[model samples]
Target: MYALNDIVEMKKQHPCGANEWKIIRMGADIKIECQNCGHVVMLSRREFEKKMKKVLKKADSDK
Candidate 1:
């Protein structure tokens, strides 16, 4: 399961040639920023789930 600030890879690489994205927002919709180009986008949770390949890293948080 992914949450805010997690870094993830998508099924397809971005046109900018980046496959990694950082989660910047989470809710009914999810927002991510491209790791390579600083591009940002928001997608529905369903879309995010459909496109997400795997989470590369989870956000660090104090428990």
Candidate 2:
């Protein structure tokens, strides 16, 4: 499961060559921001889950 502020890595890298993304929003859809370039993207929950490779850091863990 993912939560807002969670840092995750997608199976594929972003255009900026970054695979790390920070979860900014969550719901039926999820919003992620690229850690390298500050690019923001939105994807459906199902799609996001499918593409997600691993959870690098949990939002709560950072606290």
Cα lDDT of all candidates, in order? 0.93, 0.93
Write candidate 1's Cα lDDT for 1-63 as tens digits: 988889999999999998999999999999999999999999999999999999998887524
Against the true structure, candidate 1 reaches a TM-score of 0.91
Q: Candidate 1: minimum summed lDDT over ten consecutive residues — where? A: 54-63
How far does residue 7 in candidate 2 sit from its true spot (Å)?
0.3
- Winning candidate number (TM-score): 2
lDDT of 2 by residue, 3-30 (tens): 8898999999998888999999988899
What local lDDT does model 1 show for residue 50?
100
Model 1: CA > 4 A from native = 61-63
Which residue pairs in candidate 2 collide?
none
Question: Which segments of candidate 2 are over 4 A away from where they belong?
Answer: none
